[model samples]
Target: MITLKNVTLRRSAKVLLDNASVTLNPGEKVGLVGRNGAGKSSLFALLNGTLHEDGGDYYIPAQWRMGQVAQEMPETDQSATDFVVEGDTTLVAAQAEVRAAEATDDFERMAHAYMELHDAGAHDAPARAQALILGLGFKTTELTNPVNSFSGGWRMRLQLARALMCPSDLLLLDEPTNHLDLDALVWLEAWLKRYEGTLVVISHDREFLDAVTNVTLHIDAGKLVRYGGNYSKFEDMRAEQMELQQAAFGKQQDKIAHLQKFIDRFKAKASKAKQAQSRVKALERMEKIAPMLADADFSFEFKEPANLPNPMLSMSGASFGYPPPEDAPAGTPPTVIVQHVNRSVLAGQRIGILGANGQGKSTLVKTVARALAPIGGELTEGKGLNIGYFAQQELDVLRPLDTPLEHMIRLVRETAARGQNHGQGTREQDLRSFLGMFNFGGDMVKQAVGSMSGGEKARLVLCMIVWQRPNLLLLDEPTNHLDLATREALSMALNEFEGTVMLVSHDRALLRAVCDEFWLVTRGGVEPFDGDLDDYQRYLLDEAKRQRESLKESLKEPVAATTKIAESEAPKGATGTFSLKNAPAQRKLDAQRRQQHADKARPIKRELEGCERRMAELTQEKARIEAQLATPLAPAAIAETGKRLKAVGDELHALEERWLELTEEIEHTAGA
Candidate 1:
């Protein structure tokens, strides 16, 4: 746990946090939210000791280790694994020294080194590392891949994974979900839900905070206000408070007006003069109500696309996978990533894809978009079908030097030159209008693409997509960087889009509220389901509960139900008779409740503890594995070790599943 006492931070002439006091406890998720340029990130740095404060004091426990995931990373020419492992460079150096001592056959030194290494569990670090990598959406194949090969978005994810894996009592995440696709986000949400340490994250993603955080901290007017509950709960409470404040202010204003009128009419009168002066003093002392800042009421209407034929895209005995290039021939077949896949996309359908990361979800999208031709199988585009693809890294498509207006104008000219537009001038006007709808007006429209945030770039990409109005839109993680308000706006536009949409998103609330059908991209293959996201989630829950029940039934033990019945149920000071005749019945009821609780409660508590234990174990294992693999080992030795490592990994995964099940059951029983 960590506490901030009388923490005041300021810039040249502006106050950021003024005498701010907050206490963060273990297992509590806190959201730090404010408007743009409101110093959310600055506050994070202050907490992490990366920024110096100008006034007051920032207090952190001396024994506590704090970790932070900043918005930016240092430019390093190293592999992603190398960058991540460097999070604890002192440990890495110690490992190297220990290894050297062993190699030199210095028995005494080796023995000492061995103790240190064993205590650190440097041998098991690799497994822990792999778990973190997989949980953060990295495939085994990409573990050794150079960090620079990935886009900035992916690089951000790698940085975040490092932060999550690092040992910390307090974790500060700044826009942690900015680069994650839906799958990674979901995994992160689940992980953070069971996270035992304290966390304060700055995010624009409401669903992320709502799913993970218990408290909302609003930074306004250089002060921090804490609200109990999630984002939605906070909003409701704030609204009620605002209404009361407004009413109070209205009453005060009326009194002030009446006093002014009395002063105007009777100021010279001796008795009236004294009374008017008292009213003036009271009015001056009264503080005005601060109006709540609300998002502008902005709605976007999509340009409806014309109807197209059925079977917009279809795959028969098809495979969705990427093949690695062989060493031998130029014309040889690519490696098969996803095989035996059969699916079809039809017009007037909005489909949501759900899957774990590294499950070929992106591959499927690519195949359908014709960005990559399928290695095997036939994929056909229906007649009259026009497709627009929104890749997860769509920002890469933007010319960094090009201004927003330039890109819009250039795109329009190209489209017009192809003879598809009403006119060049008209197209430009439409582009400008579309940009305006997205809150990019005048000077903002002229800002270079390189200067925009990920969310802004995504919004701009969407504007272009809507401008084109393609019959079929393939969107990959479109809402990754968008804030709650922008996300809602995009969702509304997509709902009214008059076109076939296939999207991959991890925000369950958004998916549940927006999607009409499901396309689950599993490790095995893509399976289509006939319901919305909420229904699919419900189905998953039901399946999990059924599995739990089946396991419980197999145990065949007579576990008494736990239900508490209180003795002396009458009022505390009641004059009526309080009978002791039903004591046996009450005792039996109490015993049954205790037994029932033990039956369910022990397992849940044990499982939760097991999860925490496993997480720590995995962390240690990963650190060890990374250190071992860092040395000059033979290829065969490495391969064999990797296989053993994979087994440990599989066990870790099973443990994670069990943890999720147990925690969910506990929540359900508590709710009940």
Candidate 2:
């Protein structure tokens, strides 16, 4: 169990946790949630031992191993399989022991080391690692690709896989689904459900938390509050709590008013002075109940557009794709991802774009947004047709060095240049006021966009889009950076908006809340999907399994499962007998035995190497924490470091013990 007793924590001058306490039992899947900057990450840091309490005590069982995704981008040429395999430090250490024993030329030690290596899953490491990779939406062909060859988002997925590969008693995942599409997210939820450890995840996707978490930990106003259910249940319970708190506060206010009135009316009279004084004392002693104030959660509404265009856009045999790069030869043909797509977007239509990652979803959206042109088909826009587009990479359209105000001003200039101004004011003050409505008030309007958080930037993009008052909204993964409050706010705003909407998002809540229909982009074509989000999820899972199975089938051996080295139970030179006494032949017999041992051990050794890397990581962290303690530090900080050191040390010891036990069984089996 993990316990924080009356913990008071501060990040700089800000009090993140004030006398906060909570207990988390083992094997619980907890969702840690709060508004942005509500100390969720701070609590995570405290749990992982990077931050410390200024007051009170925090404790986690010393023997429990912990796993967390590394925030840094991985930079390595190692194959993806090797990279994930190395995450298991236990296997690495076992392999090291084998090499050392072989160097010493000790036969018994070699035998023991071989057994340990087998137990550490040396033979099937790549297979297990590839499974994790594929589960996270990687192709089987990419299993042996260099890690550094992937893009940033894919690299982050790899980071997640590496964390999942580590053997741990506790796993901490922060925004684990931000980079994932729907298919990958579903796979991850299934994986976490099967994990036999304590899981604490921070995610903005409401459905994800509900799927993976059995408990909810909410941090609000410097207090840690535990809820006995998942995210949706937490919302319902909190709403009820707020309702009750408000009623209590109203009653308290009425009582206080009555007490004050009696005191004021009777204090001047001689006979009633004593009674009035008692009432005054009663008022003074009364414990006040504070009113439940809405926590200034981010909320906004879309501005009603000046006009609505029926059949906002029409595509006839439209082909959505990318043009050749500038460096490509002149005759190179454009890549057509989606072709022969006849679709119509009418006013007030809400559409959800459904497809696997890289299956032309984004290409279709890019064409609709005018970022790409149709290859060999007609795409026509109705008069007064206006689109407010949110690209998946917000940075692609956002100028990082520019401030929010500057971005708005640029929008205005471009809008005017196109002679498409709708009656809205383009004045600087009006723009500033509009930005303020999106929570970019005062100096925040001038803050460089590059320095803002992802959520903030996303809000800015939404603000600019609202200012345009477009008759059509094209949003691609708009909720990627938004927290729950803002995501809900967007959902509400979209529901109320009268514009035509085409959305591509992994957020199921948003899709369910706003989309009236779904358009699937698959096999280079587009068509209406007559199914709900649940059906789409099932389709994704089935497709993923089928693709993976196909890849596995391609790599399977033609030989029978029970194929072995001999036609009969006899020696190579002798008939119906086996002997090992031949001096030169003894070595061959021993070698054969070792190979047989390893081949038979494959089932027992499957998937152990990935955890061996975790042991190495802990060893390094233990050393770093030890060195940190050696330096002069604040007493509280030193205490925190000491706690972390003990945790790492005990975790390493536990891993070593488990490794020995696994090797022990394998050794006996191999010897027999």
User: Highest lDDT among the candidates is held by which one?
Assistant: 2
lDDT tens digits, residue span 1-672, model 1:
566677788776778888887776776789988765567877877877778777666667787777777567556677666667666534565577666864764555554554455455444455566567666777645665788888766788878877876777788887787667665666688888877778898877766888989989888777778898987667667656765776654644554453344334332322333223433332232212111212213446567666576988888989866666657577776767677887878887777787655677778887788788788888888986767788877655578788787888877776678666522245566768768877789889889888888778887888777676688888887877776556656655665567788888776555654455677776467787655544555665565467557445422221321231122332233556545556677567656655665666667676677787887787678667657756866655554444445456556756755664565565445323
Q: In model 1, which range of ten residues has the least summed lDDT?
A: 285-294
lDDT of 2 at 161: 93
- Model 2 whole-model lDDT (C-alpha atoms): 0.78
Which residue runs does candidate 2 get wrong by more than 4 Å?
Answer: 105-112, 247-296, 548-672
Stretches > 4 Å off in candidate 1: 1-27, 70-123, 138-158, 179-187, 239-299, 306-328, 335-342, 373-386, 422-433, 530-672
Local lDDT at 429 for model 2: 94
lDDT of 1 at 328: 52
Q: What is the C-alpha RMSD of each candidate to the true structure, in Å?
A: 18.8, 18.6
User: Which ten residues in a row are the worst by lDDT in model 2?
Assistant: 285-294
**TM-score between candidate 1 and the true structure:** 0.63
Give model 2's TM-score versus the native structure.
Answer: 0.75
lDDT of 2 by residue, 374-476 (tens): 8979998988888999999989789999999999999999999998776777788988888988999999999999999999999999998988888899999
